[model samples]
Target: MYSSLRSLADDTFCLRLQRAARVWRKVSDEELSNLNLSEATTTPLWLINKLGEGLRQRTLAEHMGLEGQSLVRLLDQLESAGLVVRRDDPSDRRAKALYLTDAGRKLAEQAELVVRKIRARLLDGVPAEHLAIVDGVFDKIITAAID
Candidate 1:
């Protein structure tokens, strides 16, 4: 099936990206489900871990492209699960800084492991140069889209 309105090239990249994301999420979820975590849940942990100290809710929401309320809800869930904590920022009186508990940090590391394994599995037969080319192409696509 194809769109009558646009060329195949117009939709093919988007379709492939969407499908790839779905496949990655599905496999990641399967692995994380045992720990009651999905790709969605793991994302915040990953971001927090990456950002290290002084990560704020406002900044995190911006990174995730989520509204403040949505991020707060997700954070609430994580907090309740004893994975994360928010404290008054030392530098900024109004901002709340996010810190991962030992459990949260551990989960973030586990999530990274799961992602790396999945990536290796999916690209096992692909050449390193080919992967690099694909990465470069996607980088261009992202830059163009953002601009």
Candidate 2:
């Protein structure tokens, strides 16, 4: 039945996602080991590096699919390491905007290089033309998941 087929497909997709996530985590851990940063700290650093200044921690947390408490814990680590700082929002005293320190920016750039290299290695044998489709599929998957 179509319903069963759909369920099967969903399960397969989730399994593949988990596998890929595990691989990514392992690669990141190995690559970032020299920095003495944990996965939790690295996550916010990566997000802040991408979003830059003026982004709210809560909003960024939602975008990254993390719950509030988890995000707070991550932010605490990043703050303690002097990699990021939270400033009082001009419009809302209760809200805070995240900013990356110069040190954070330098580390983020290095981390990006590691990610790019790992991605390139993973896609090494794939045809160049297929990259567009691969990117499209990832976009579609993210959109669908969000929706």
Candidate 3:
């Protein structure tokens, strides 16, 4: 059985994590809320910034680990938000390519800063040497679940 102190310690850690997440989200949400960008667009926006240079939507979807209608829905929302625009692939009329708009690019830049600030705040109290251990444990858990 867990002792009261042990339980209290676990609860305190969980509370801190929850509060950190909330703070991180607040920074993002406050920064982006007026821009009409949804939180879901964050991943797709990053993907576009990384690989949308000349890739097709289908490839982007696969890269993002999304499939079929779900990807379509995300793409639709992004398109509707004017953050991303889809155009027919000149190489293949059947395929479409994606690109970020000027506004999207600008917003993404601001979002990046917000994300960095959140990271800074979260890691402020953490020692650099312990980061590797934290990363290692997270990677182990993720790999174990995926594998």
* TM-score for candidate 1: 0.83
Give the residue spans of candidate 2 off by over 4 A: 1-10
Between candidates 2 and 3, the one scoring higher on lDDT is 2
Identify the leading candidate in terms of TM-score: 1
How do all the candidates rank in terms of TM-score, highest first? 1, 2, 3
Between the candidate structures 1 and 2, which one is better when assessed by TM-score? Answer: 1
How accurate locally, in lDDT, is each candidate?
0.89, 0.81, 0.76
lDDT of 1 by residue, 10-50 (tens): 78878998999899889989988877888888889999999
- For residues 1-147, what per-residue lDDT tens digits would candidate 3 score against the true structure? 567988989889779867965876676666567665555567678778767455689888776667757888988888788888888989999998888988777777776666677678768989987999878966785578668
| Ten residues in sequence with the least summed lDDT for candidate 3 | 31-40
Cα misplacement distance, residue 17 of candidate 2 (Å): 2.2
In model 1, where do residues sit more than 4 Å from their true spots? 1-6
